[model samples]
Target: MKEDMYSIKMRAVRKEKHISGAERIISEKEIEVLVQQLTARALGHSKGKPDFINITIQNIGNQAIEYIAPLNIATITVDDYFKGRECAIKALQKSGLSCKTSQAILNMLKTCNTMRGAILLDIHSLERLEPDENRGVRVTNIDWSFKIKEDLEKALEKKGLNNNHVKEAVALASKVSNAPGIVAELCWSDDPDYTAGYVASKDVGYMRITKLKPLGDSTGGRVFCFDSSKTSIEECIEYLQKKVTLIHKIPMIKD
Candidate 1:
C-alpha cells in the first residue's frame, strides 16, 4: 500500500435519534483530527488502527483542535473507558443526547474499532453477541440518530419509506416509551423560511420522545426517548448482556 497523508472529511450526520448521551462531544475539528489520525493508522503510522479517543476542545463546529491524545491512546484501563463512557453518556443526557447515541458510541468503542476489536477477541474469544427476544436492543446495531437522516434518505430511495409516511412513522417511533424503537421521519422547519429533512429520535443513551406529533413539528430536534419507569433496569441489563456483543478478548468492567 502507498504511504501518504490523506484526509477524508465526512459530514457529521446522526444515524438515529439518541437519548442516553455521548461520553464526549465530538467537535467538527476533533472529528477532522480523528479522520486524519485514523487515516494515518490505516496507513500503519500509529500504534494501531483508529479507535475512539478523547481530546480537549477549544471550540465546537468552528475552529477547534485536539489538546491531548485520543482517550483510546491514553494510558487507561478498559474499566476506565466504561466509566468514562457512562460519564459521557450522563453528560450527553444532560445536554440532550438521545439514548441511541450512547449505545452507538459504546458499541464503537467496544467492537467496531480495530484495536478494540482485537482486544475484545482476546478477552471474549467470540466474534459476535447474540440478541435474545428480551434483549432486542444491541449496542452494535443501535443507529446513531444524526446519521439516521442521511441513511433514511437513502433508505427511502430504496422504497423503505416515503416522506409523509416516514414523517408519520418517525413520529410514532419517537413516542415509543420502551426501548425506543428506531425513529425515521421527514420533517420541516418554520424558521429561516426554508428547511426540511429527516430527523430521528435522540439516542444519547436514553430516548426522549414519547409521541409522534413533535417529530412533525420540528425540522431538527430530539427524536428518541427511554422512560426509565417503563423500561426496567433489569431489562436494560439483560438487553446489554445479550445485545452488547464484544469482539473477543476485550474486558469490560463496570464501575
Candidate 2:
C-alpha cells in the first residue's frame, strides 16, 4: 500500500551485502607504459620503444636501478615478502610516480620475482619530501600518524547512530504502514565521543536497530534498539511518514 516502500527496503538490503576481493596481479606491458609515463614526468623525456622500455625502479632490497628494457621486475621482492596491493602502491610512490603510474608499474613488476641492480626504494615520493638546497631530489613528505584507536571509537559511535536511525526509520515505516519516506538525522548530542546511534529519548527509551544481511554470508549490519517497547514498526513508519520529526537525530560524543 505504501508507495516506494519496497524500493527503499531493497536498497537498504543491498547496502548490507558487500565484500572485499583479492588484488589483481600486474602485467609487463602495462608496467612499461607506467614507466614511460613516469620517465616522461620525472626526466621530461619520451623514450619508449617497441622492444624495450626504461624507467627507474627501487627493488625491495633497497637498491635503486634502471632497467634498459624487456625486464620484468616484480613490485615485491625477498625483502618485502608480503606482496599486497598496498605494497605495490608504496613501491610506485617511492619511485616518485603517481598512484596510477605506480599501479601500472606494479602490474609489470609482478612478472619477475627479483631483478639485479634495482635498489631498495623508500616509499616516500620526491614531491612529498621537504625542500633541501643541497639535495638533488627534495624530500617533501612528512611522517605523521593518527590515533587510530580514537578514530576507530568515533567511527564506531557514528555507526551506532546510523544504525539507530536505520532502526527508527524501519520501525516507523512498519508501524504506520505509510508511504515510503526517508528517516533522516535532525540533531545529535553534545559529547564529541558519542555516536549518532546511541542517544536516547526520555519518551522513546533506547532505540534498537537490527542490521539485515542478504541470502549469503555477506558482511555489514548490526542489531540496535530504541528504548520504547510500545513503539511498533508500523507506528514508527507512520510517524516518520507524517511527522518525520525527532530530537537529537545525530549522535553525540562525550569528551
Candidate 3:
C-alpha cells in the first residue's frame, strides 16, 4: 500500500487583516506535527499574535509527490553565485530600474526581519503599493494545482531538471510578469537553511542566484517590481490578492 500525501495551508489573520500564510506538502505521518509547528510559528511571529488562524488540509494523493520532491542538485561555488547575482542586478537595471533600488530590494529579501508577505514596488516612482493601514499585500490561498505541458515537462526531463520548487517559482513569476505594469520579481525563501533565490522577468524568465542570505539566517520575502504608469495601484493589488494564478508553462531559464 502507498502512503498518503497532503497539502497544508495555514493563514494568520488579525482583525480581518491578513498577516501571514504558509503552505507545505507533507506525508500523512508528518501532518499533525507539521501543523502544530506551523501554527506555533505563525502565532509566535515577532509581529503580534494573529486573532485567528485558518488551516486547510487537502489530500492531493500520492501523485502530488512529483510536485514536492526534494531539491537534490549539486552544490554551486560562491564565486558562481555572486556572478549570477551581478548578472541579475544588471538585468533588472536594464529593465528601467535603478541599480540602487534593485540592490535594496535584494537586501530587503536577504534580511526580511519583519515576517510579512510579498511587497509591491513601483519601478518608476519607487513607491510601495500598500493599503491605507497595512504595510504590504498578503498573497494568500494561492492555487498550485495546474498541470505542466507535456512537451515542456519532457524538455525539462531531458535537461535532468526535477526540481519542482524552481518550476513553481518560474511559473508564478511568469504569471506575475504578465500582469499589467509588472516588470520583474525578486524572491528568496524564509527557511533558515535555504539560501537560493531568483530574479525573474517577463523578458528574461528566471535567473537563479545562490547565497542570497547567510546559512541559518531566517529572513526572506518577495518583491514585485512594477510600473505605476501602466496600471493602477488598486488593480495591481487585486490581481495578486484575488486572481487564481495558474502555472500553464515554465518560462525559459536564464543563467
Candidate 4:
C-alpha cells in the first residue's frame, strides 16, 4: 500500500539484534569491530561498514557499548589514553570520512543539491576548533539527530503542509489502539540537520526503533517506521498499509 512507502534519501539503519554473552575485551594486537549498534545479525551493518564500523574500537573497560560508539575516553595513564585516541583518529581518517566539519558538510548540502543523505552536528563533532576536530559529519548517513525542530516549523509556515496534516498523521499513529504511545513526525530530508528512521524492533523486546535512521532518494520525506508488532502481524500490516496511504496523500510543498 502507498507504493510500499516511497523511498526517501533516508534509509533506516537496521540491526538484527545481538547481546554479547560476555564483554568483548580487546588485547594489544587485537581490536573490535565497532558498529553503531550490534544486532543478532550485526553483519547487516557490513553493507555500510565504512560508516558504521566507527574507528574499529577496543573494549577498554570490558563493557558493552551500544548504539553510539565512544569516540574518545580517558584511561589511567595519559600515555595510553593519548595513544588510543591517536589510533582511533588514524583509523577514522583511513576509513574515508573526509568531510571534517559541519561547515564542510553544509557546503556539501549547498553545492551537491542531490544529497545521498545529510549529517547532523553532534557533541563529538562540535569539539573541533576549525577543521581537524570537526569530524563525524558525513553524507549518505542517516544522522541520528533527526533534528528538525526549527526546519519543520519553517516548513509549516511555508505551507509544506498545514497543521491538519501533522495532526492527522499523529492522530493516525496514536489511534492504532494496540500502541497508544506511538509518535510520528513529518520529517523533511533535504536539510543538513535532518534524518529519519524506519520502524524496527529493539533488543529491549519492544518493537521500537533505537539509534536507527534510514536514507534513500527523495529530498521529500516519508512516513517511516510502519508494521508495528505490539499487536498481531495481520493488524500491524493493515495499520501500516492504511497509515501510508493516508500520509502519502497528504500534500507536501515542493521546494
User: Taking the candidates one at a time, how many backbone clashes does each contain?
Assistant: 77, 54, 0, 18
User: Which stretch of 10 consecutive residues in model 3 shows the poorest summed lDDT?
Assistant: 64-73
Window of ten residues with lowest summed lDDT in model 4: 69-78
Off by over 4 Å in 4: 1-165, 176-186, 189-217, 220-229, 242-255
lDDT, candidate 4, 166-217, per-residue tens: 3322323222322221122112233223232111111111111111222432
Q: Rate the local accuracy (lDDT) of all candidates.
A: 0.28, 0.24, 0.63, 0.25
Q: In candidate 4, residue 194 scores what lDDT?
A: 28
Residues 1-255 of candidate 1 have per-residue lDDT tens digits of 412222222211122211111112232434565556434433342122223332223222222221211000011122332344454445344434456654443343332211111111111121222233222222221111222445545644454333432332332223222232222211222112222222223432222221212222322222222334344444543432223111111111111
Among the numbered candidates, top lDDT falls to 3
- Lowest summed lDDT across 10 adjacent residues in model 1 is found at 66-75
How does residue 243 of candidate 4 score in lDDT?
26
User: Residue-wise lDDT of candidate 2 within 46-139, one digit each (tens)?
Assistant: 1112132233332222122111111111111222223333543453344344676445433333332111111111222212111221211211
Better of 1 and 2 by lDDT: 1
Q: In what order do the candidates fall by TM-score, top score first? A: 3, 1, 4, 2
Cα RMSD (Å) per model?
A: 20.5, 28.5, 8.0, 22.5
Task: Estimate the lDDT of model 3.
Answer: 0.63
Off by over 4 Å in 3: 1-8, 11-53, 57-84, 132-135, 140-145, 149-164, 250-255
Whose TM-score is higher: candidate 1's or candidate 2's? Answer: 1
